[model samples]
Target chain A: MDNFSFQNPTKLIFGEGQIAKIANEIPKDKKVLVIYGGGSIKRNGVYEQISAALEGHQWSEFSGIEPNPSFHTALKAVEQIKAEGVEYLLAVGGGSVADATKFIAAAACFDGDPWSILSEGARIRAALPLAVVLTLPATGSESNPNGVMTNYETQEKLAFYGRQLFPKFAVLDPTLTYSLPAKQVANGIVDAYVHTVEQYLTYPVGADLQDRFAEGILRTLVDNGPKALSEPKNYTVRANVMLSATMALNGLIGSGVPQDWATHFIGHELTALHGLDHGQTLAVILPAVMAEKREQKHEKLLQYAKEVWNISSGTESDRIDRAIDETRAFFESLGIATRLSDYGVTEQDIPAMIAALSEHKMTALGEHGDITPEVSAAILKRCL
Target chain B: MDNFSFQNPTKLIFGEGQIAKIANEIPKDKKVLVIYGGGSIKRNGVYEQISAALEGHQWSEFSGIEPNPSFHTALKAVEQIKAEGVEYLLAVGGGSVADATKFIAAAACFDGDPWSILSEGARIRAALPLAVVLTLPATGSESNPNGVMTNYETQEKLAFYGRQLFPKFAVLDPTLTYSLPAKQVANGIVDAYVHTVEQYLTYPVGADLQDRFAEGILRTLVDNGPKALSEPKNYTVRANVMLSATMALNGLIGSGVPQDWATHFIGHELTALHGLDHGQTLAVILPAVMAEKREQKHEKLLQYAKEVWNISSGTESDRIDRAIDETRAFFESLGIATRLSDYGVTEQDIPAMIAALSEHKMTALGEHGDITPEVSAAILKRCL
Candidate 1:
């Protein structure tokens, strides 16, 4: 295992009715700023639950954070935060809302232009404290400090992270997700699965416990992701999926381990260019990357096949292919298109995505930092 | 899964040469108090590393924290903290020393009798900040806020926990454990294994991630634990073992799951009465406890039999018995006898141990609180 230092201080309040805990988690004296995407919370019971929990608390609301939260909109929230002097942020929807809240929190407190914090890798010295009422379980942003936001004008997607943005508390009531659409649930499952693979399926790091933890998240998603879609109201299935997503990217599985995030970096390019949902981009790109870089990640791919896919009897190359096939199939089963053509993308589009990678200086990616723009183009071509 | 809230804030600095980070982790202005066990760190060259790190920092030293960490001895450290007004503590040895430092950190700021805090469940409202240089891998007290210390005068062992008592940082330099005796290595393995099983081998609670995490820790220990004894200097093996022990009881596995620490509760009694090592007591008693509660814990036992021990080809009763047998055999292979009689704990010692349980009010233990004193006695009788 490599040398690493880790510390995550997000307190998770998880169960059926943990939303009511917002009353206790947030400070009584603080003026709260609640953030969410669209009006889903209002359509569901989450808004009413938050209203009831923070009944008399002094607070304001910022709606329409949007999926794949954009900085153009989050800047507005940051402006409101500064104008109203919002002391605390309550992110009350899915990961995008939480991501927006984190972005706003950082921007509100940043001494300089906060856009540079994402685009230029600026340091976040301090940010407003935030707590989460996670109605969506796609991104583990509720617990993790890092979040990705898009720049609509530049059509660029980027991520920013610091110790300052970790939620002070995260309330995960799986029942709140019962009202979510089947598509969103499927997206969540794929999102979490890819997150686990990003941290895992890289190299043998002697991080046995971390490997098991990563696989455990994968297995949990494989077993319950479909069940969550089929029976949205099943508390047990939703609870497992919800918890797995939180654990997937909460920094536990990646600690002291060699994590390959080539898929995510490449997938972000696709998301930026094609406006695909984050998980759909992942579903389109990961198998191609896995196939292209099979030799570099051969041993772990075999382990993933035997342990996660239960395909131990095949030849090495065959097992890797089967694992990738099973992965694409899993995403397809969720009503997602794993091939670029299925999503209406052609081989002609590969160069532009590869150019975007070059503009972003994405020459070195993955655990070995060898996923050059050429390699990325090859992976994208295979996706076609 | 049950409703649960969880948070652990201990910064884990893990790898070789991490000891030098103490200067950065602790406050520069605070007068530090360094604590450790009987000169082992000194002999292992850990002392030189710690001393070099504390070169420019103002610090005092306290030594001689025993194996189980005596509260009476820790009280003296509390007196020194009060006298010197030590603002922070640095525990440089194993879990016992860290446990003692926790006691001292809590007791120094405590208002009422500190013993009442242990025996009377006095609330801990404040504590001095502390960091650890962990030389042992048995107890996960480094990452967790809980600690167990023996009251030597009362012949009682008790645990104290509060959010305030968590270490600010824990430096896990795997090389520090390289000098440990083979016996200590075996004990660390058993201690970590039982800790995982205590949280795992009760009943399935829909906590698939947690169960897999527990099994992951168990599998790591099973695979590399013996290698830690044989090839003491193997960094990969020791790192896996060290990391496994920390993760085993750091609340990740136990979260939202009904944990069965009845074995630990019963095992502590044997430690207090017969002076056996904590891990030895666990090894001696856990198989018997599994046997005794086979009916109540049937489902989880079957799962454990298949997943952990791979003993699936038998009748339900036979598989459970075989699982228990495999557990005992694993401990025995560690060169630690798995029966109480081998440790000179005969059936005659059962009555006094039962009295200890009654004295400690451990009448109801296990996940379902079904391990009554009578049930515990029966388990002990079988161990004999």
Candidate 2:
């Protein structure tokens, strides 16, 4: 295995009625800003539970952070946080709100323009400490130090990272997810599965423990996804899904290995251009990316086939093909469309996407760093 | 699933030539105490690497912490640390030295008799910060908050736990184990395997991800043990074994699960009474414990059979028996004895071990809390 240093200090408070822990987790003296998206917490009783938990705390609320967590909305929250002298942030909704809260936390302490951090990918110095009441199980923003922020004017989305942005604590009560719409549940499952695949299906770097962990998360998502959709109120299904999401991108699978986030890098463009949901865009791009990089990722493809998809008794090429087919099938099983045309994208958009990728000088995409702009275009065309 | 709060803040610096990073990991201003066991590190060249790394630091060395890490030895280290005003500790040998450093770090800060903390098992208020340069791949003291310390004077062994004693960082270079004696390697393999099984083969606790992770570590140990034994110079095999040891007791496997460490507790007595190695004691005791608790641990044993040992075609009883037998065989394959008699322990030692276990009043010995003292004694007899 390649040399690596790993450390994640996020304290995970999981199980029923864990939302009440938000008050105790954050210090009593710190002024708090609770961030949410579209006020879903109000309808789901999460808002009431959080309010009751923080009965005496000096706090305020910032609502209506959008699904993709745009820079503009997060800047407004940062303004409110500065105005209120907020020392801590509590994100109470989905990954979007959690991601936005992270941005707001960093922006509150940043000296210059907050957008500069997103555009230039600046290092974060200090940030208001943040905690989360995680009602959504996608993105794993609660435990990881990564945030994907979008710019509406530029039609661009990009990721920024800093160790200081990890949540001080996250309260994940699966019971709070009982009211989630079936589409969101399916999206969460697909997002988590793709997350594991992006980390696992690159190349075998002799990281056996990480490979097994990634496969374990994928297996859990596949085994438990259908049940979660059909029985939304089932605590076991929600618990399993919640745990799977946390494990998928908590920096566990990606340690000591090369990660092919080429699918995610491409998926972000689809989300930026077509306004597709993040998870849905991944469903559209992952198989195509796998097919494009099959030669470089052959051994891992065979391992993924044998361990995850159970596609043994095949030649290397056959195993890779079957693994890619099985991946697309798994996403389809989650009711996600795996083709660009299914989302109403025309052939003309392919050129613009390729141009956008090339403008970023995005060569060396896969584990071997060979997915140049030309290869990216071919992958997108294959998706079409 | 259970309501749980999980956090591990230990920074793991892993892989080839990581010992050089030790200088940057520790604070420059703090007075440091470097602790070690015997002089094996000098022979292995780890001492020169550590001495070169400690060039600019205010550090002192305390050697001679023996196997199992007795409190008697730790007290001397504690006194020296107090006299020298040591602010931080760097444990530079195997688990024994690291475990001893944990106790010393805690005891140096406490005002009362140091042994009271071990005998009475009280919560520790504070501890000097500690880090590790792990030369051994066994006890997992590098990444965990628990440590076992023995009292040679009284012939007693006990485990003490305090979150404050968790290492701030651990440098794990698998290359450090290349020169270890064959006996040490065999003991390390058995110790790591039993650690995984202790958390796994109990009852199904709905911790699907944790179970998979535990089984993954077990499979890695089994797959890599013989190679590590035969090809001691193979970097990949040593790296895999080293990583398995860290993963085994890093609290990842016990999350949201009911863990049965009854084997470790029973095994410790055998080690204390008969002067056997910790891993050897475990190898002899675990199969007997499994046999005694087979009815209570039925479902998980069948699951272990199917997933880990691949013994699927059988009745429930047959599968459980086969799983237990396979576990014993795996330990024997590591060159460990599966019965107490194989190590020359007579019948007289059995009653003393039973008395030690009874004094601890560990009635709930298995997953269902059904292994009473009588059951434990019966299991011991089975081992004989």
Candidate 3:
């Protein structure tokens, strides 16, 4: 195992009726700004529960943070936060809302242009204390320091992180997710699954606990993701999926290990260019990346094939092939199509995706930094 | 799954050469108290490294904290802290030193007789901030708030806990354990193993993520514990076991689950009465507990048998029996005898053991409080 230091201090308030915890968690005197996406919380009764919980708090609201959490929308919240003297922010929708809240929290307190926090890498000295009522469980933005946002003007999707971005507390009541559309539920599952594999399927480091933890997350996703889709309101299924999603990217399995994020780096380009849903692009790109990066990730693929898929009694190449096929099949099992053509992405779109890698200086991707722009183009062609 | 709220704010600084982190983690303006065990640290060069790291810090030293830390010894340290005006403490040895430091930190700031903090359940409102440079990986006290201490005067061992008792930071360098005696290493392995099973081997709660994480920890222990024993200085093996031990009781697995700590509770009595090591008592008690409570833990025992021990393809009763036997054999393989007679305890000890449980009001134990004193007697009898 590689040498590492790990600490995540997010106070995860999980389970039914946990939203009321916000009443005590946020100090009574702090002025709060509640952030949400597209007003889904209004239709789903989430907003009402949060309002009931925060009955007497001095608070304001901002809505319509889109999926992919555009920077423009978050900048508006930053301005509102400054204008209203918001001391604390509560994100009450999906990862997009929570992701946007992270940016808004940093931007509101930033010294200069807010976009520099994402584009020019301004150092963040402080941020608005943030909490979340996570109505959705994807992205793990509720518990981590990383947030991804899109610059609609530049057609760029970018991510920023700071130590201050972790939520002061997050309430993950799986019951809050009961009213989500099936497509979004499926998107959450795939999003979480790919997030785990991004940190996992790289190479062997003899990090036994980290490997087992990553496998455990993957296995939980495989076993429980379908249950979540089939029985959306069942607490066990939803709780398992919700907790699994959080654990996937909450820095538990990723610590002390080499991580390959070529898939996500590529997937983000697809999302930026084609306007594909975040998870939709992951389904389209991951299998091709896995196939293209096989030699670098050989031992892990064999282990994943055996432990996760139970397919070891074959030639090594046969097992690798089977693992990649099974991965694509797992995506399809979730009603997620894995081929680029299935999403109306084509051969002509390949050059733009490869060019985006260079434009973002993400050419040297993967655990070994071997996924160059040329290799990325080949992987995308495999998606054809 | 059960409803749960979870948070652990202990910053864990892990890996080789991480002892230097204390230079930065502890503030410059505070008087510090350094705590440790019988001077194996002095012999192993750990003390030297710590001393080398604390060159300019205003710190006082307290030595001679015994294993299964004593409250009497801890009280002396508490007094030293008061006299020296120590604002911060750094525990520099194994679990005993770390555990003693937790009690000292709590007792120093308690506004009453310190024993009241333990025996009379004084609610703690504050504590001295503590940090750890862990030379032992066994009890997980470095990363958690719980600690066990013995009262040598009364021949009673007990535990105390508070949120305030958690260390501000813990430094775990596997290289520090390189010179440990093999028996101590074996004891550490068994201690960590039983700690995990105490949380895991119970009725299922449909907590998929929790279940997977528990399984992952158990699997890592089984896979790496022997490597740590056979090759004492192997960094990967040492790192894996060290990390697995920390993760075992860091509240990840036990959350949202019906945990059976009957093994630890029973083992504590045996340790208190017979003066056996914590891990030795666990090895002696756990398999017997598994056999006696096989009915309540039937499904989980079968699952443990299948997953951890790989014992399937047999009758249900046969599988359960084989699993228990395998567990005992594993302890014996580590040169730990798993029966009372092997350690020279007799039937006379059983009455004293039952009295201990009753005296402590631990008459009802296990997940559902089904392990009455009578059940405890039955489990102990199986050890005979």
Candidate 4:
């Protein structure tokens, strides 16, 4: 295992009726800015919970943080913070709202243009305290310090992370998710599954516990993700999916291990250029990446097959192939089409994706840094 | 799953040469107390690493914290802290040292007799900041807020926990374990294993992820613990064991799930009465607890048998019995005998052990609160 340092300070208030805990989590003295997306919280009763929780606090609302949240909208939230002196941020939706809130929190405290934090890797020196009433369980952004935001003008979707942005608290009431559409639920499962594989499926470094943890998350998603959609109100299934997503990318499994994020980087470009939902992009890209990088990730692929998918009675190569097949099928089973063409992107669209990868300087990616633009292009063509 | 709030804020500086990170973890201006047990760190190069890390800061040392740490010894450290106006604590040894440091950190600032914190459940209002340079991989006190401190005067070993006592950070350099005796290595393994089962092996709450995580820890320990003793210097083996031990009782698996610490509570009495090491007591009693409570824990024991022990090909009762037997064998394979007689406590000693549990009001012991004094006595007779 490689040397690593880890600290996650976000307090998770989870289960039924947990949204009320947000009242105590955020200080009443602070001027709070509650952020959400597309008014889903209003329809789902989450807005009422947040309103009830903030009864005694001075607060205002910032709506319309979109999926694959853009800096264009978040910058407006930062402007609102600057004008009103908002001291705390309450993100009341899923990953996008939480991502935007984190960005707004940092951008509000940043001296320079906030886009540079993502585009130029500028350090985050300070950030407003952020908390989340997580109505969606994908992205794991509610607890993790990382966030991905888009620059609409540049057509760039990028990630920025720092310790300062870790949420002060996250109220994860899975019961709040009962009102979510089946497509959204499926997307969450697929998103969390891909997150686990990105941290895993690279190679073994004798990090057994991490491998097991990664497998556990994958298995939980595989077993409970489908049930969450079919029986949306089953608290156990929803709780499993919710917790799996949070654990998938909370930096625990990824720590002390080599990680392959080529799929995510490529998926981000798909989101940026072609406007695919984040989970859909991952679904379309991951299996191809797995097949393209099979030799490099041979051993871990076999392990993933056996431990996660329970496919052990085959040759090593056969097992890996089956694992990739099962992975693609798993996403497909969630009603997501895995091929690029299935999403209306043909072979001709591949060059544009490769060009975007080049523009972003994501020529070399993955754990071994060998997934050059050519390799990525071949992987993308496989998705076609 | 049940409603739960969880947060662990301890920064982990892990792997080789990470001990130097402590220089930045603790403040430079604070007067620090470095605590350890029996000077093992002095021989293990941990002392040198700690001293080098503490060079820029003013620090003093307190040694002789025994195997099962006592409030008596911890009070002396607290007295020194009060006299010297120590503001920060650096625990430089194993769990005992870390546990003692936590107790001392809380007790130094505590009002009235500190024993009330354990006996009377006095609230902790303040505590000195604490950090750990963990030289051993058991008990998980380095990162967890909980600490068990024995009151030698009363022959009572009790646990105290609060948010205030969590270590600010922990430096876990697995290389430090290379010099440990084989007995200590085995003890660490057994301690971690029992910790996992205590949180697990209760009736399932459909907390599948927690069960998977618990199983992962158990499997990692079963797979790597013996190798740690055999190949003492293997970094991978040592790292896996160290990380597994820390993850075992760090509150992640126990959160939102019912935990049965009947083994631990019973094991504490054996330690307080018969003078067995904490790990040794656990090794001797856990299998017996499994057998005694097999009916109540029937479902989880079946899951444990299948997932952790891979004993799926049997009747439910047979699988559970095999699992218990395998657990006992696993502990014995570590060279820690799994019977009270192995520690020279014969059948005659059962009454005294039961009396210790009675005195502590451990009449209702497990997750179901059904491990009454009678059940405990039955469990003890089986241990004999």
Q: For all the predictions, what are the DockQ values?
A: 0.88, 0.85, 0.88, 0.92
In angstroms, the error of model 1 at B109 is 0.9
Give me the candidate number with maximum DockQ: 4
Please write out the lDDT profile of model 3 over residues B123-160, one tens digit for every residue: 87899999999887888888889887889898777778
Candidate 3 residue spans exceeding 4 A from truth = none
Give model 1's DockQ, 2 decimals. 0.88
Model 4 chain B poorest ten-residue lDDT run: B150-159
> Comparing 2 and 3 by TM-score, which wins?
3
Candidate 4 global lDDT: 0.90
Candidate 1 lDDT over A1-384, as tens digits, reads 999998999999999888888898888999999888889889888888899999778999999887878899999998888899899999988888888898888899899888899989999998999989998898899999998888888877788998999999999999999988888889889989999999998989888878888988999899888889888888889999999999999988899888888888888888778878878998988999899999999999999998889899968999999999999999998888999998789989999998988998888988898898988988999998
Better of 2 and 4 by TM-score: 4
- Name the best candidate (by lDDT): 4
For model 2, the DockQ equals 0.85
Clash pairs for candidate 4? none
Worst 10 residues of 4 chain A by lDDT: A150-159
TM-score of each candidate structure, all chains considered together = 0.98, 0.97, 0.98, 0.98
- Candidate 2, residues A1-384, lDDT tens digits: the string is 888899999999999988888778888998988888898789878889999999889989988898888898888887787678889899988888888888888888898887788889888898889988899899899999888888988877777888899999989899998998888988888889888998889877788888888888988887888888878888888899999999899887788888888888887778767878888989999999888778787888899998888788868888889888988988888788999999999788988887777777676687777888888888999998
Interface RMSD of each: 0.7, 0.8, 0.8, 0.5
Tens-digit per-residue lDDT, B186-273, candidate 4: 9999999999998988988989899899999999999998899889999999999999999998889888999888998999888877
Question: What are the runs in model 1 whose C-alpha is more than 4 Å off?
Answer: none
Clashes of each: 0, 0, 0, 0
TM-score of chain A of each: 0.96, 0.96, 0.97, 0.97
